[model samples]
Target: MDSASVPFAALDYIIFGVYLFIIIGLGLWVSREKEGRQKDSSDYFLASKSLPFWAIGSSLIASNISAEQFIGMSGSGFRVGLAIASYEWMAAVTLLVIAYFFLPIYLEKEIFTMPQFLEQRYDGRVRMLLAIFWLLVYVFVNLTSVLYMGGLSMNIIMGLPLWGSIAGLALFATAYSLYGGLKAVAWTDVVQVVVLVGGGLLTTWVALDAYGGSSTGPVGGLTQLMGDASNRFNMILFEGELMYQNDEGVTQDAYQLLPGLSVLFGGLWVANLFYWGCNQYIIQRALAAKNLQEAKRGLAFAAYLKLLLPLIVVVPGIVAFALDAPIQRGDEAYPWLLGQYVGTGFRGLAFAALVAAIVSSLASMMNSASTIFTMDLYRNYVEEEVSESKLVRIGRIVALACIVVATLVAPQLADLDQVFQYIQEYTGFVSPGVLAIFVMGLFWSKATPNAALVSAVLSIPLSAAFKFLTPEIAFLNRMLIVFFVSVALIVGISYVENRGETHPKAIDLDDVEHDSDPIFQVAAFGILGITAALYVIFW
Candidate 1:
């Protein structure tokens, strides 16, 4: 390695040191308020439903924007083109739907963990199965991915060994999550989101400035750099290619919606609804809001935040590609871009921001996992009589234990070339089943516990077949096919098993109100309008 390329310097370390201190301090500050409370399951799990909309919204954004976006999504942008940005842009609509269509049911019911809703709709067995599945998925896919990539990003930025970075992240996450729970994660995330977005925009601006200042001069310079003349067909055509993957750095188009129709329709929609609407790690913050109005406001805030995410996470990636930086691996772009454009004091702050993003994600996942374990799994199955204080104590222990296990697994994450792909591949195992069961439970009264269990059981093998048997089929297409098949299986079997007798309780949608903030509606429309304008421009 070159002398300049050592993983970190005193400056980088100092920045990270300050970041760690502030985050831990925030955790301690949030913990102070809970010092003498009853420390019940509700308090340990949902922060006693006392958070404001801004804090919940910021925490949601921070939890979602991990090293995966900074490292993986940006790297994908470098390899392919702007097409990879759909993940960010499309989520705006998803969040809007969640805010208006989904959050009401959850907030109205006052559910602690989402799996609890499954029990209310189905049975204890379904709830237990889902809780276990979600718990494992969080630890293996979400938690591990966050820590593994966070460590890798730090190593690349600082010129340190990967293990050192992993240890550092683990220690920081453990301190915040174990000591403070959701309260700590939420407040620290507020600071984390600001730093991360600022750092990302700074990187993107530097990249664009570099591209625009070339000898060719601004417009000519940017166009020539961004275009691949030899791949005319790729540039004009969009559907056939996965927007996020470029076989060899080709400038594939993002204009056509046909290729990813499934993702645009049900596949991506299902994932987003499941993720933002019902998932523990993402929605736990929303559930911690002081009231239904606050929860709705928080979700609207997150929706607005989602609309702006592409500016921070996706645009820099496009810049990376425009600069002709090597992005054979999607996880390499952010570090490569940061290493190229950043220097000195700013580098320290940017590095600190990246660290904060990773820690925020880790803390979110760890806290959520602890919640599911303590409230859904342990309280229901293992220890039914623990007091509130003891429950909190158990949650702290569970959080630390999960961190240790995930850290050990972090080193093995190196072989997973594309972090986002790895996340989807593993998550697909359970996401489809979970999504199916949740949708049915919420909207279909006739859906039985047996049907939920059977659909979940059958969806796994069907998903695996799509993964291994038809390897050439796009992942999004496979998800759509799996979703329909699972739906068919569940509905068909339920009809037959019930002998044409449907459950008599009708879902009361009349009680659901349409009271979303006007600002959010405007922002949602603006996102759609911008997407349409982009399509027109490219066409």
Candidate 2:
């Protein structure tokens, strides 16, 4: 499909314009002064730690479900079917665990960033190392990928040029986030999530409506879609089962990337735990919550939202396949469907949703990168006596710089076959070791700082070597191997270093009480149950 050939009508343009107006107004309004009071770093970076559960939850979803999920995951759905939803479904459970097990510690410590938590647990060296690493990833990897995908979608569906789309998105996100920071990002995210989910569902419904030929009714269309694409509905794919024939005319295995049951019990956990529990951008909303209960409740809400994501993001791709939508690449599935099925007025809303996903993620990443730079590095080391006002200024400067770098780098990602999978595969190398360090740091008293440091240093090279030497091993399995090896290294080094010596009191774990929110507990159980049912039904 030549995306340039599709034209949007006036109503679509009006709707899109109105959406932009309302969101910008809402963001500015929400972050505006109450009786002329000024916002400090606490307000700018952490929303003054006053966000409710709903705001926190909505922000989490908005930050997590970006153009990557819409374009990348949907593309995966087009090629690999329902199995790709494990990322979404499994994340629900991961969010629950983070809520119950992780939030208490973070909240008790009153920490602003993930690296701060590491510094509290280990040393400033670990804090400084991870902070710099996270800053680089947020700017180069996370921000760059989101910008590229968002630009690609806009170029395809809205007829905008790629560079123009990238610049527009960067400016749009920076417009609000630079001044209002997390307060603006979190509040605006509530609106973005509504639009994103609504537009996504609208696209899915319209695609399903057009699933069968003209002779078929809506129900018949659905039935025919399922009947024709039944092979694509499985949640657990076995090795060697042919998934899809690519443009190159080569058939790929159903479980080639996911590696079947390993998604359920293996390295997937490492990825999820690292992402949901440790990643700064994703967890920042929770960290900014008013209390541990609110954070837990917020996470529970995100968990429920995660359960519904596949319906909006994944189902449309499957529908596209069922209808044999004339798309050039699997990543074009969502945009192609928009060009075909969505009408004028709703087309703008759909476009707004895509823009919202892109902008929200961009804002979140910028804010987090700022947080790490300003709070972790600048305040602690560069200028310890900096005023809150000066720190906020520094944050804005750092955020803008990061955005500029990301925008410049985004276009380079155009050559990738699937930007989403590329992100996962590359990030997997470090996530395992990071997860191992956090797990041991939190639970194992014998885990020495030197051991954690060694594991962190060696984990990436080990993963790279494994990737090069044993290219046939699935990436997920490689993550599993790296995670265990990292754990072993941590354990062995800790034992040898601490041999015949009394354990240091400095390494004692934080004694934070669990958030005993009944609502959170019930919601967690309910989400887990639903996740289990989804796998059982779809498997």
Candidate 3:
């Protein structure tokens, strides 16, 4: 359990240092001033619809792979076996749909935020409702969970107390993001992806090596975990034992699967679709792309990374659990493993990577919250004719305010059990129904505004009610039911409302572009193939 017992060398530090320099440098470089006219809200929030495929792709990855995955997700994997990886796999199919189906409409219409699309399709009140709901969500759920959990990890690694670590994380993230805008966050995220991914791989490789060389027995350090009764993290499929006794004889199957086929078919898909497609914190990067072609490419690129994420996040935690390192949940797994395994200067690099991941995530959320507030609420309702500089100023202020609120809420993270699951439950209310509205709107011309409105209004309460009613049902299964029911209602309402009406224009498909390169195609297929392989191996 000591820091001295690993293969990590000074070269890791060199790799990490070079990586950090390049990332911060990218942010500073991209922070260049806009040419000619003063910047508008669009420029600040959406990158003026001019970001290339790679920047958008990096931002998407950077935003999505926050400290939650490293800390919360990997930690969950440590406790739950490989089943937790379903989130990543489901995302591949979701992105494939988005790239092929969703991007065309978003780009053609030149939408600023997802809520704006809602306004056009339904009413401004719905947009405002969503805007406020989403903004508060970022403050409480995304931003706060990430910052607090990230601080907890850093604290575990650096041996700092709760307050100091959390405060530092909030301050640093808010400072850079508040100073630079979406452009800053996107560029920083590109850098963060390299470090976070590299550090993740480094930890996994080291842990696997340690697992191979375990002093206790013939089993690899990683495989020994499967043998240990104390480390039984795999999902149990049996009925009648809704909760089983752990090694300590205290019942704790809260994270286990096998309630039914419902979770596999429905529960996970709802979470995945909501997360990858509808959530503002995740989808804002997609919205920032230059055009349909780049947006699709960017989404496909992110899908590719999602496929590889488990190797870094999930696998290492299993290895750590196998080693019987002291940690709680999956959130603390990475930091504990790194502190134990990584050597001196390499430790700094690892810590930096952790900081980068946390900061990038926080910065992404802050910028996005600012984006929603300025574009969806401020411009639409508060101040319609504000100058470009003033809008940017307001956006920055909003970002700062969100960070402050999130920072105050960060400490509350320690109170939740199965923190990731808790987050999914709350967000679930909105995401599935929202996804239905967008999907129905985009593909089905007959899908009327009334249908959209009805689905939006009813889906959340219905999902919540079903979840509440079905105490025997797994959350995932219940979600699947909600998703299908919402979809059905959407179709039914659209049919009823559009009985004899001609559909107005949704998005002009012909004007949209698909200028993809061969590399993108190769990457896309490669990612999908890898995801399929993972499912087969785990299944």
lDDT values for all models: 0.73, 0.86, 0.72
Give candidate 3's error at residue 66 in angstroms: 1.3
Model 2: per-residue Cα lDDT over 313-347, one tens digit each:
88888888877877767788888888878888888
lDDT of 1 by residue, 1-539 (tens): 42324355578668767877887887888777535556566766888789998888888889998888877777655555555555666676677677777777777778888888778777888888888888888888888888888888776666667888888888987887677788778877889889888877666666666666755544553465457422321222345444434445554433322244454565666566667777899988878998766776676677667666765666666666656665455676678777777766667778777877888898888888888888888889988987788888888888888888898988898866668767865676677777888777667667777888887787778889988998766666677678777777778877887766655432456776666567666766776786556545543
Query: Lowest summed lDDT over 10 consecutive residues: which window, candidate 3?
Result: 229-238
Pairs in clash, predicted candidate 1: 6-159, 7-158, 7-159, 7-160, 8-158
Clashes of each: 5, 0, 5
- Of candidates 3 and 1, the better by TM-score: 1
Question: Which parts of model 3 have CA positions greater than 4 angstroms off?
Answer: 1-26, 34-37, 214-250, 254-264, 328-330, 505-519
- Give the per-residue lDDT digits (tens) of candidate 3, residues 210-280: 66775643236556555663334433333543443333446666443434344456567667766776677
Best by TM-score: 2
Give the lDDT ranking, best first.
Answer: 2, 1, 3
Q: Sum up the clashes in candidate 3.
A: 5
Off by over 4 Å in 2: 1-5, 34-36, 213-220, 246-250, 500-510
Which candidate gets the maximum lDDT versus the true structure?
Answer: 2
Native RMSD of candidate 2 (Å): 1.8
Superposed Cα deviation of residue 237, candidate 1 (Å): 5.8
